[model samples]
Target: MTTAVLALQGAFAEHESRLKELGETVIELRDSDDCALAFDRLILPGGESTVQSKLLKERGMDTLLRRKIEEGMPTFGTCAGMILLAQHVDNGQGGDTQSGALATFPACVRRNAYGRQLGSFHTVDTFADMQVPMTFIRAPYLDSVEDSVSVLSRVDGNIVAARWKNQLVTAFHPEVDSDTSVHEYFLRM
Candidate 1:
């Protein structure tokens, strides 16, 4: 099966490389035309959520990609990608809220919940019952999730990873790490 990585912004190349290393054909979805390509799965990489969301809408890919995801296209999101997929987003500025991009995942997220870039750190945590490395860079943790969402992994009691049906999300960047366990899990799904 092929995997498509949203390349409008962020660490798309890293995800592509990881997928290729796993012997998967990878495609980069940079515009609406690219989104029309046939792919089995999708990966939304870490980056600025606002910028990525704006670009996706501007390029006319927002609605199309959302439809694909909602139609049971297995998707994996990391960092800002998780924010894009969340149904609700709290900017953490006293009730400031931002509209979700795809909003396919049924969860609420707090943007920059870990503070700024300086707050970034790395740790090994349990994900899908496996000990894997987690890299959080200005990541957003899931403050709440619907009953349909399955909590996958947490750091310090905060929900950092979860899965809801065909959607999988993490407030950390798994592409930056060498471990392929997370990617393998997504591939299997």
Candidate 2:
């Protein structure tokens, strides 16, 4: 299956590499035209959510993406991508007014909930029953998840990962690591 990775900014290249390593066709989605391409899955990689959101809207791809996602496209969002997919973002740095979020996941997200860049960290966390080392760089954490959301993993008493329908999100960067366990699980989903 083909997976479209938003390459507007951030660690998109890393995600594409990981997906390719898994033997999956990868597409770099930059603008609205790229959205027309046939793809089975989508990956919103770790990056600056505000910047990514701005680019999507400016390029008129946000609307198209929301439509596709609502149509049941399987998506995997990491870090800032998680913030983009959230139904509500408690982005302490003022509300998301300029470039709004996709609001796909039925949850509230606090941008940089893990603190500043100096607050970045890494740890071996259990995800889907496997111990994987997660890297968190100025990541956001889920404050609340609705009943429709299934908690996938947690770290330090915070909800770091969850899934809702065909959408999955993580506060850590799995693509930056060598382990493909998480990516494999997403493919299986």
Candidate 3:
């Protein structure tokens, strides 16, 4: 199956490498034309959410992407990607950014809830019974998930991973690690 990884920004290359390592055909989605390509799944890598969202809309691919996800395209979002897919974003304190979000997943996310890039860290955790290393760079944690959401994994008391329908998201970057289990899980979904 072909998987399209959003290449507009962030660690798209790293995700591409991991997906290829798993023996899957990968496509780097950039514009509307790339969005039109036939693919079984999509990956939104960790990066600057505001920048990615702005680019998506400025390039006129935002609506198309939202349609694809709504139509059941299995998607995996990491870090900033999770923010893009979230229905609401609590910008920490008590404010929200309404524009530019894809709003596919029924959840409220808090951007940079773990602080800035300097607050970045790495940790090993159990995901689906398999030990995996997660890298968090300016991560955005899920503050609240709707009833339709399934909590996948958590670090400390914060929700880090979850799934809603065909969409799966993580507050950490699994692609930055050597392990391919997280990508494998998305492929399975």
lDDT of each: 0.93, 0.90, 0.91
Question: For model 2, how does the per-residue alpha-carbon lDDT over 60-81 read when each residue is reduced to its tens digit?
Answer: 9889999998999999999999
Order by TM-score, highest first: 1, 3, 2
Collision pairs in model 1: none
Candidate 1 shows a clash count of 0
Per-residue lDDT of candidate 3, residues 80-110 (tens digit)? 9999999988886657456326889988888
State the lDDT of candidate 1 residue by residue for 124-164, as single tens digits: 99998999999999989999999989999999999999999
Q: Which candidate is the best by lDDT?
A: 1
How does residue 92 of candidate 1 score in lDDT? 92
The candidates, ranked best first by lDDT, are 1, 3, 2
Q: Compute the lDDT for candidate 1.
A: 0.93
- TM-scores for candidates 1 onward, in order: 0.98, 0.95, 0.96
Residue 111 of model 3 has an lDDT of 89
